[model samples]
Target: MDYPPDRDSWFAPLSLDLILKVLNVTFFHPFIAWIIPLSFRAQTMHWDAPPMLVSIAWAACLTLAWIAGVVNHRLAYGLPRHVDLSDEVIVITGGASGLGLLIAEVYGMRGASVAVLDVRDMENGEARGVTFYKCDVGDKDQVARVAAQIERDLGPPTILINNAAIVNGKPLLDLDLAAIDRAISTNLLGAFYTLKAFLPSITSAPDGGTIVTMSSVLGHLGAAHLTDYCAAKAALTALHKSLEAELRISHPRVRAVLVEPGQLSTPLFHGVRSPNAFLAPVVEPVDVCRAVVAAIDAGRGAHVATPFYARCAPWYNVLPAGLQVVARRLAGVDFAMRSFRGRLPVGENGERTE
Candidate 1:
């Protein structure tokens, strides 16, 4: 299988995420923050001294903020469910390659029964515990048939990852009706189809199950030459929220995880460069895989946003229209897709190379 070529330079690794990662462990960490004041005291610094006072205050603020963050998480997400890999039957769409493949391989290696549903064959041919099913999610009949087959072959699926997607790098005016239909069908309606086909089995399980939606930051911030893609993703975000709300009431054991990542170094968006590499660096599939795996393993519903800019994507909508346009110009959000050369020429059926 051919992978996307790496075009990043030595400095590409020096992104804001890298800087913040270091700061998080060293400065922002509550334990490390307190260490500063303790170190000052070890040097015989008076408690009321300017330096000591400042260090103590900084530590106090960090500690309080950390506690608040924990409280907020608990209040927002509630408690996590129990997860046992041996008993899990996992299903991942678009597991033929890229992010979905990475996740399938992870669980496959960990002794879980993983079923991969995709229109194409698995990129690596095979995996240890993964069974590949040739199914296009955009086709409701295919999804329905595959769901039944999976239940028979691998038992009821306890985890479902809706990660299948395709990019049609064309402006709205340039896109034909077929292209628009394919994009929306595959990117948005596909999730609905899969959920409808599999949710019954998932909900009927004694331990319940998890549903993961793979959205994008572009969903929140519409970009040029990606009208169909953006619109589909935006709808996906809404679908995820509504599904979560319904599951919370109907089946409290069912978990819903939402992942909205920035541009990833995958063939899905090959040749699309970030306008500001430091501030909006391309995300890695592995980074996203880690977050998804962590949430599933912990049996918790999470709002996973990769790359710092992705987490801030929601605020873009709240800004004034004039400021929004200025910010878009500065970030080159609309221009980013101008050079987009996706994995391959997508068909009207939304065929994806990765």
Candidate 2:
């Protein structure tokens, strides 16, 4: 299905994130930094000259920072395992649409054995190589049966992507028991069920495997209307951390990647407004899919956050309660979901039916 246009106005087109992306490949780059110093020296400038000295310092700082990033990754994620697309079987939950569908389609087209498990049918029908299985990941019995089927149909899965998620944009007081249960079960327990069913196959793979957990920034900053969703996502982040620590000692070859993206422009979050357009422009599924694909292809663990705000969201948690409350008010976190219309089934007239 075709995605809606960005529709952002001219000024909305510019963001701090866009500027940072440009700088990363230019002025802030080590190569670019060194080039400035070399160009200054080519003019026969003295070593002690202000421009030359400043350029050298800048280059040194950039290089050191780059080195530190490498060191940080080594310490945090350890080493990468080997992955061959031809031999790796991938299983993605909620592979019917949005981000999960994108990842499944890419892997399928690239010749990896792919299995898509979702209660809904493939949104755009079957892709070239993706095999669809109708399974609600929240149900352990169904997940177990599908796992066995996948194993028999296409060897053992070497990569698992836990991307299924559902959101009910109602206040805690307004949500019914069934709605709360559905949100928690699908968003949190589904991950646990999938992991329990697939970890054995992932660990048993000869070349090891990777696990991708789809989380959200809401997990870090709870909002008014999303109490249950926030709680579930927060638990997922903790689960990822604990699992990573445990696997580091027992199955070092298995990698874990955590994706925490802000408001995405998908059917899942149809009418929700962004708190700030320039600061938190809704992320596209393709942008996020690229990061996930890269992490899986490299066989390394990573924490993927889009837009500048998401990368800095951790700092907000350290702020005082009063300040956090003020920030939430200013950012409209509580009010953003006021008009939310999720991806419930719709008829041809573009009106929701369920």
Candidate 3:
């Protein structure tokens, strides 16, 4: 489905994220920081001058911070595993559309064996090196059957992306049991089923594997009119953390990446409004995919958070209760879904209409 661009003012492009991106490369970078002092010296500035001293101190601080970050990552995730796409078989749930589809197509083009398991057909028909298997991740039996077929057809899986999800933008009182069940099963239990079915192969693979879980920032902060969706996403974050802990101890080579992104500009979130465009601009799916692909290609475990606000999710939980309420109100957390018109309406059999 094609989604039209959101209407915005000329300044819509000027976001906190854009400002930070510029600062990261020009001001915060170690190389750039050191260049300032070197340029000052080239201009015949005395070594003890205030400007020279400040520049040198700034460069040293930035360089040390960069080294500390590298050391922290090494201590936390250990060494990176090797990834050779040609020899890996990847399975992506909900690869028929959205972010999942983007990742599948990328790996397919790169000569990896990609199997997409979705209840719906592929949105763009056939893709090179990608085979579609119609299977609802919510159903354990269907997933089991598809797992066998994928193993037989494409060889053992070395990468699994648990990206299947469904959102019901309704208040708790308004949601039916069936809708609630579908949301939890698809968004939460679906990850468990996929991991159980494919983890063995991934763990046993000679090159190990990477497990990428697609979660959301909403998982950290609950929103109104999205009770079930929020609950399921929250559980996914917990699930990823626990699974990552176990994998690190028993299977150090297996990398587990947790992706918690802000609102995305996808058909899944069609008419949903952004509460604060400047502070919380809707992220493009391509940007999230770029981070994911980079992590997988580098064969490392990562926490991929998109948009600057997403990285601040953990901090939100530490705010006082009263302040949390104020933050919610300021962010319009509950009100943003009032105009939500998801991808399409659900059909009689629970499948979404194209």
Can you tell me which runs of candidate 2 are displaced by over 4 Å? 1-11, 345-353
For each candidate in the order shown, give its overall lDDT on alpha carbons.
0.89, 0.89, 0.90
Cα lDDT tens digits for candidate 3, 1-354: 645555553125778999999999999999999999899999999999999999999999999999999999888777899999999999999899999999999999999999999877788999999999988889999899999999999999999999998888988999999999998998999999999999999999998999999999999998988899889989999999999999988998999889999998777777887889899988988999999999999999899997898999899989999999999999898899998877775564547677
Scanning candidate 1 in windows of ten residues, the lowest lDDT window is 1-10
TM-scores, one per candidate: 0.95, 0.95, 0.96
* Top of the candidates by TM-score: 3
Model 2 lDDT tens row, 95-179: 9899999999999999999999987888898898999998888778989999999999999999999998888888888999988
Which one is best on lDDT? 3
Which segments of model 3 are wrong by more than 4 Å? 2-11, 346-354
TM-score-wise, the better of 1 and 3 is: 3
Q: In model 2, what lDDT does residue 133 have?
A: 94
Lowest lDDT block of 10, candidate 2: 2-11
- Alpha-carbon shift of residue 341 in model 3 (angstroms): 0.3
What lDDT is reached at residue 42 by model 2? 88
Residue 346, candidate 1: how far off, in angstroms?
6.5
